[model samples]
Target: MNAAANAPRKLPGPVRAVGRRLPRMPASIAFATALNLTLRRKFPADVLDRLEGHTFAIVVEDAGVELLFRVRARRFVPVAQAAEPVLRFRAVAWDYATLAAREADPDTLFFNRRLLVEGDTEIALLVKNTLDTIDIPRTRGILRRVLRAAAPGGG
Candidate 1:
């Protein structure tokens, strides 16, 4: 059997305890990596070329997740250490992943408070609308199917 299949299953509390002991990248970094990989082809060349130095915040609340990304002419550096976000949002992890995979409607998410956008409304809209236009790469199919299978009732 695979290592995972042989591993012991723990309840939520024990799972949390184990999780706390493991080393993990920040959730934001993990999410960003997935985004970059899934949308690399759809990303405007100009945007991808300039993404390295951009400063943006991803705010996630009970509602959903919002990304506030921008490309500046100046050299890349993160400026806002504590300032209010240029873009902000909130959403549950599942809803955010669903939207990313194009399995859920952005409008429905926004209206249901499963997603909320704030900060630089114009920029936020631009980012959100642009993301809506892009499609996740085919590699996501395997991962997506696995996720759906693991979800309650298989999504």
Candidate 2:
């Protein structure tokens, strides 16, 4: 047996102890930080300023994946676990990836309900509209700049 399989596993709580793996906080945190920067440039300061104290949960239902992101004091904070999100959005991972990469139309999925949102409908709609209005090339340029800054000699 592999060394990991032979070890006594510790169960934290109600959740099952799926095999333990190295934590990926660095990449996730980086992604969230980059995403926040993109949001700031794409959206008005007042709109983003009002996002404080709201919890958003993005779920990839088919994959049984969940990511909890909370807006606290005008910053996006990733939570280990969250209960009763103020907003929940479910979508296929590919669709979201495509949208994020600027390869797909966010409106098509939203109109077809492939991208589902629950709770705080008005705010959600506003977010969707804002995302739709973003100029893909400009957004990509900003993101590329951010990536370059993150890496030494990356540009």
Candidate 3:
């Protein structure tokens, strides 16, 4: 392959600017809101109820976003900024998008070290297993489109 083929494509200036601002935005709030609605609808009340009071952090390494969350009143909410997390998951943006889109399996990503889990191992495994079992076609489709749009050279 030529150098051009091997080179990383850059996003357009405007898209790059938007990407830069995304991390600074209320990422935790947005994430919590989205998950609160979707997870609640997809999973049973009893299932989510078991995770009550558990705090988890999602660290998007490439995007430089860290969001902490917890379960309260059977609703998932973003933890306060100062809250210490019990379980933390770390992955690059693209990897996470594909994982959410169902293009990548959790075990595959974990085996490859593309995704990482820190803190409470039991809770981490529980989340991974829960995510693996759920099938949200609509949400996955939306995530696929959003990721494609944000990808370098996609536009």
For each candidate, the alpha-carbon lDDT, in order, equals: 0.53, 0.61, 0.71
Per-residue lDDT for 46-137 in model 3, tens only? 76777888888887765556777788888878765535677888876667777778766677667667678878777777777888788898
Residue 66 lDDT in model 1?
33
lDDT of 2: 0.61
Order the candidates by TM-score, highest first. 3, 2, 1
Candidate with top lDDT is 3
As a TM-score, model 3 comes out at 0.76
For model 2 the TM-score comes to: 0.63
Model 3 residue 11 lDDT? 35
| 10 residues in a row with least lDDT, candidate 2 | 1-10
Error in Å for residue 54 of model 1: 5.6
Q: If the candidates were sorted by their lDDT against the true structure, best first, what order would they fall in?
A: 3, 2, 1
- Per-residue alpha-carbon lDDT of candidate 2 for residues 14-100, written as tens digits (9 for 90 to 100): 232221232434434654686677665566666676677777787655444566777766567776666778888887554555466
Residue-level lDDT for 116 in candidate 3: 84
Model 2 off-target regions past 4 Å? 1-30, 136-155
